[model samples]
Target: MDDTSFLGSYTVGTDAGMCCLWQPEHFAHVTSYDVWEDALGNDPAIERSIEAGAFVPLYLHSDGVYQVTLRTGARTPREKRYTTASSEPYLLVSKGAVALSGIEAVGADLDAAETIALAPGRYAVEVHLIDWQAEPGSTDADGNAVDGALPDFVVEISPEPDPAPPYRRTVETFDLPEE
Candidate 1:
């Protein structure tokens, strides 16, 4: 059995859950699963690469319409792609109204740097928006200039490559502290 916690701890380390292509029928009794991708490497390929990768941006019971398009510097899909997980610290507001919580990432490629599973409550999640001062450019998928004002972009937690980030994690079995 995997005993894990999302609330980060300074005294110890974290063990990113293992992500595998397991057959569903083999584990029918399993309530849920945690499928972690490769370790958050030294540097996420998305940080500097100009490839625009698309994915399910927000966290929820069911993934919504894919509206999150990361890496805005790419001109084509094959030029840059979403190959692995990103360690970038994106704002993760609790879905319910709560002061603190632990949100553990379960997908094959997802995580919140520190352990902060959400507590039982409500929260309006929204990434802190960033006002970047840059040149104004209008362009379409066909590489044509368009007329419109770019909305302020949010600064995300820079993601690292599949290589493990600067951290240590492992699965250990031990006696639990007595109440």
Candidate 2:
């Protein structure tokens, strides 16, 4: 029997080249620039966490609106033409929900945003990169031909045990890019 179940799906937009699923309460102080410069920062630990599925970073090649689908299951979905970029664990702490938005939209009013409700705990997130232009005549479910466009991603969130220590992140400082 298939244990996977669809939770929700959303079309999120980003202008900062990245989007993330975060516990709003824990990220109240996050600035627009902090998302990439501080949280990601190209540090080895951060990279390791990303590999271990401990920190969820949805990095995009370029900025635009993309489809994000959420699901709960033990097995990751196997897409014939898509690439499984990475799957990592994210330690989510919240009253009972999490917010999905572009880094620039973090602290804004998200009441109407794509907020996912879940029991506070650890969850595994998998990012799948889809390149529709790679295949000629390929089109998304909506029948739109996004030729030569940046890749879109699908994130899967599932409950997981706490990851081992030393996998924690220390947000390092970095120079913000000139706008």
Candidate 3:
């Protein structure tokens, strides 16, 4: 696997007041698929990746494409306020193309993320995270100033079911002299 293929770690944690390192999976090459075109939306690069089996769509939502999952770290059901945040903000799986797949501000401390069904295979993946900044007069649903950013990263995927290679088939026929 190449060092340039990864963006960073998917999750970050604080231990005894120390920041952990960001270590994500890596892959030498990727095999992309366009399995979410209809459900999501369209992108020429995504289509090309699928055709070439170079990368797959993990999450996408922009310019009419909406495909992602909501994640809220809140545990209590009656918590008045629960803030949601995420690392792994944006992704660029193609050779040199970048894509945004992070969630926007909703309410009730809800966060957004992407989900994909894999066929069990090793994949070169791009991981996206949020890099938030404070806006002077911005306000969220809960009356808090909105601050967020989209940062892209990369990782390697290993599906359990292991995806099948691109479809290919052929036929052969033989003929005998009217025996």
Candidate 4:
């Protein structure tokens, strides 16, 4: 079967619902964009390909974020589609600390607290999707969404860790009046 491990997929009702919930491994250097304005409309050159069922993955190098947008006419039903993959972003660990770990939807807004802290070190990280495979009928015989394999990411920490952020203490002294 084709590999869709790096792609997120789901179907929404006519009322515009979410397809799936996916939490990116790291939150640093993450930013959001408007699908209609930024991805599809920004570049008029790629308009033809996009309309031809091309779901391109947009990479934001500076922000360390990746986005894939799918747009369908109101008449055309939304369906799952797989596109090309690129260099995925990773969590950067410099200081010996990570801040957060929690479930988040793919298109949900992210904040500073979305990060997880780890021991101070240098690392290269990879992200993966979890058990979110939809059954043929969208439910198991018992009438529950099928749970796929456990999703997890990997990280390689370096022995020679970078120095932590610099620190400077301030000192204040007052001269007493001499009698």
Candidate 5:
């Protein structure tokens, strides 16, 4: 057999009602793109769609809390959300993948809560048991590095990347006390 584990097989659906791009429900989980313009609404329309999986953001916030908006469409038969592999760690990349001059973190088994605390910066995070793989590289199940056989995983957290920030952002604003 070929080492097809490195190659991914994703599909796109048509008629949506007639043919499914892939059996999303079949996979452990599936990710959906947000169709709504206002991602900040929290009505039944938004709350109903987010059940188990997660709202894989099509965009990112320059700053502050972010919301993912989704609307029901033929392209979106059901509410789609990205399923995080909480059970494992981030994926691995060649040492070359890391930028020798950028800010990055390298460690083993870094907690999600702790990682979120880092200021906006690039990092080469290493985790013997977990690395928090984002995407593309994350497609590889072995990227999680359960045995810690891989070297190190490099992640770039720029001012703003194409997708959401490489690391997850959880910020909460508060009201200041009145004088």
Candidate 6:
């Protein structure tokens, strides 16, 4: 399986510790509330969005600049050594176009986002965690600094006509109190 079927690559900045791949038309609906804030705190608002098929919310481990690459075909790239961090199903309900941007850029700085066209439907997103431990002082293939222990990721999106329900979460920032 060729994992080099690259669709696009983007450099996104996240001050809110999260980013998302969403359809432009559904931007207003997803951002209608403070989904970004909720995502940072791991609030229920994010979960609601996930269940409602609002968008594909990514909870980054740290708040900073990260490289996000979009690809099709094989989930993980064969060229680099990456571990399967998490895989989730995403239901895209909008036009055949989507944009990748920091959650904070929703209404304020969407102009700085990277947009791509895709068949609007259900898709699977597999997040691959880059292993920087092998080369302690070296950078990744994308020239990103490997000194920091942040869990950066590469997301592979593929068509999933029948995505299973009850999506699982990949990243969680807080723990819920015992009810």
Best by lDDT: 6
Q: What is the C-alpha lDDT of each candidate?
A: 0.23, 0.56, 0.25, 0.26, 0.20, 0.60
Q: Per-residue lDDT tens digits of candidate 4, residues 46-110?
A: 23322221211121112222222211111111121211121232323335443222212222243
Using TM-score as the measure, the top candidate is: 6
Model 1 over residues 1-179: C-alpha lDDT tens digits? Answer: 11131122111112322111111121223234422112212124211110111111222223211112122122122212321222233222232211111112322222222223343321212222122223235356675435432222211222233452332111111122379
Score residue 175 of candidate 6 by CA lDDT: 29
For all the candidates, what are their Cα RMSDs to the real structure? Answer: 19.8, 7.3, 19.0, 21.5, 21.0, 5.5
Q: Using alpha carbons, what is the TM-score of model 5? A: 0.16
What TM-score do all the candidates reach, one by one?
A: 0.18, 0.63, 0.21, 0.25, 0.16, 0.69
Residue-by-residue lDDT tens digits, candidate 5, 36-109? 21322332432232221111111111322211111111111111112221111111122112111100111121
Better of 3 and 5 by TM-score: 3
* Ten-residue region with minimum lDDT total, candidate 6: 168-177
Q: What tens digits encode model 6's per-residue C-alpha lDDT throughout 1-179?
A: 55356776677888888777766665554353465455434556555555555557666556887767677765443325554355455554536777888766754335868878777676666555555444455577787666543345566677764535545543342222379
Q: Model 2 over residues 19-138: C-alpha lDDT tens digits?
A: 767666655544555553564455573554444433355666469887776666533333335553444344444457878876556554675357888777666555556554556656
Instruction: Give the clash total for candidate 1.
Output: 33
List runs of model 5 lying over 4 Å from the truth.
1-3, 6-44, 62-179
